[model samples]
Target: MTKITLNAEARSDLGKGASRRLRRNANLVPAVVYGGDKAPQSISLLAKDFAKALENEATFSSVISLTIDGKAEDVVIKALQRHPAKSFVLHADFVRVVAGQKMTTSVPLHFINAENSVGVKQQGGEVSHVISEVEVSCEAKDLPEFIEVDLSNVEVGQILHLSDLKLPKGVQLVALAHGNNLAVANIHASRAE
Candidate 1:
């Protein structure tokens, strides 16, 4: 898995007014880190630096190395609040990762060779994705950035469910024992009709 580096500073003040002032004057993003049996700490990061780190989708879904006041820690982005109109991040949440402990997280699913699929090309069918991400359980070190789904030979009307996917070592899908359908690819009639 890839890691993203971020520099953060301890924040003393709290509440909406303080956060607004911090953003308006200092261009800082108010964030909090909680997890791993440690007390939650309020922190702030430069808006530009935080935006730059978020440009990579992997950073949102993968483990990251955050440097807070010169101390480095392994963490993952748990949640983010965004301004509804401008779509700017209002606040962010970080969860500290503990080594050797199993954690559940959502990982993106990447489709491979969809255009070359027989069902899509020769059969005049479209590939539909039911789920873009899947929840999986694994150790922090064994977490994957994304899971790949192959659609080379998928035929029309074929549905690929969660149970059909092959998970990597140390990773297991978090779902009911009966296994709900997590459609990776589905062949639908083309729109030309």
Candidate 2:
């Protein structure tokens, strides 16, 4: 996995005005780092650099090395707020990650061999995805950016449940932990007009 690093500065100014100034004057995005054992710290990240890093889909799930005031902290993006109409990032929230400690995060799912699935190819069925991502709990070291679901053997009228997912070592699906075996995807026969 590729590691991502973001440089930021600790901010003393707080409130909507200060944040507005940072964004309008400095083109910076306000963010906060919370979790672990330390108090939450307010910081500002460069909007240009942050936008570049966000271009990669895996960045959200991967561990990010955040350097604030020359001190580096391992963190993950817990939440992000963006402008509803504009393509601008307004605020970001990060959660500190401690090694060997378990954390829950959503990981993207990739369905492979769907086009060649028995249901679609032989049975003239349509492939449908019920969920594109799943929440998983695991230590930082065991975290996976995405999960793969093989659909080559799936047949028409068959639904793949959460239990059918093959999780990586040391990783557990959050839904399965609570006994929620939700359907992830399925193949259905097309209706004739």
Candidate 3:
């Protein structure tokens, strides 16, 4: 898994107005880090830096080391609020990650060999992704950046479910724990249009 380090500062000021000032005047993004049995911390980060990090696909699932006032905490992006009309970040929520403890988080799914899949290439079918991401539980150290779904052998009218995914050795899908075998992807005949 890819690890990211984000530099932040402990913010003493609170309230929506303070957050607005941080974003408008200081050009920083306000965020909170909670969970992992530790007290929540309010912090601010460089908006540009946070935006740059958000550009990386791996940032969502990857563990981020947040450095605040010389102290570092391991965290993952729990939620992010963006501006309504613009592409600017409004606020962010991060969850602390404790080592040796299992945590659930969503990871992107990568469909490989789709172009060469039997359903698409041989049968002239189209591949449709029912879900782009899946939630999984695993120790912080065993967390995977993304899950890979191979469609090379999938035939037309075939549907691949969550159980079909090949997860890392130490990882388990959250959906399976509750007996939900969600559809991940499928290949079917293209429309007549």
In terms of lDDT, the best-performing candidate is: 2
Give the range of the ten consecutive residues with the poorest summed lDDT in model 1. Answer: 176-185
| lDDT (tens digit, per residue) of candidate 3 on 29-62 | 9999999888999999999999999999999999
Structure candidate 2, residue pairs in collision: none
The runs of at least 3 residues in candidate 3 whose Cα sits more than 4 Å from the true structure, single-residue gaps closed, are none
1-193: candidate 1 lDDT, tens digit per residue: 6778899999999999999998999999999999998999999989999898888878867888989999998888989998899877889999999999988888889988789998988998899998898888899888988989988888888998888787899998887344765566688878763
Question: Residue-wise lDDT of candidate 2 within 61-142, one digit each (tens)?
Answer: 9999999999999999999999999978999999999988999999999999999999999999999999999999999999
Q: RMSD in angstroms, all models?
A: 1.4, 0.8, 0.8
Candidate 3: TM-score?
0.98
Question: Would you estimate the TM-scores of all the predictions?
Answer: 0.95, 0.98, 0.98
Q: Is candidate 2 or candidate 3 better by lDDT?
A: 2
Off by over 4 Å in 1: 176-178
- Higher-lDDT candidate of 1 and 3: 3
How many clashes in each structure?
0, 0, 0
Our tally of clashes for model 1 stands at 0
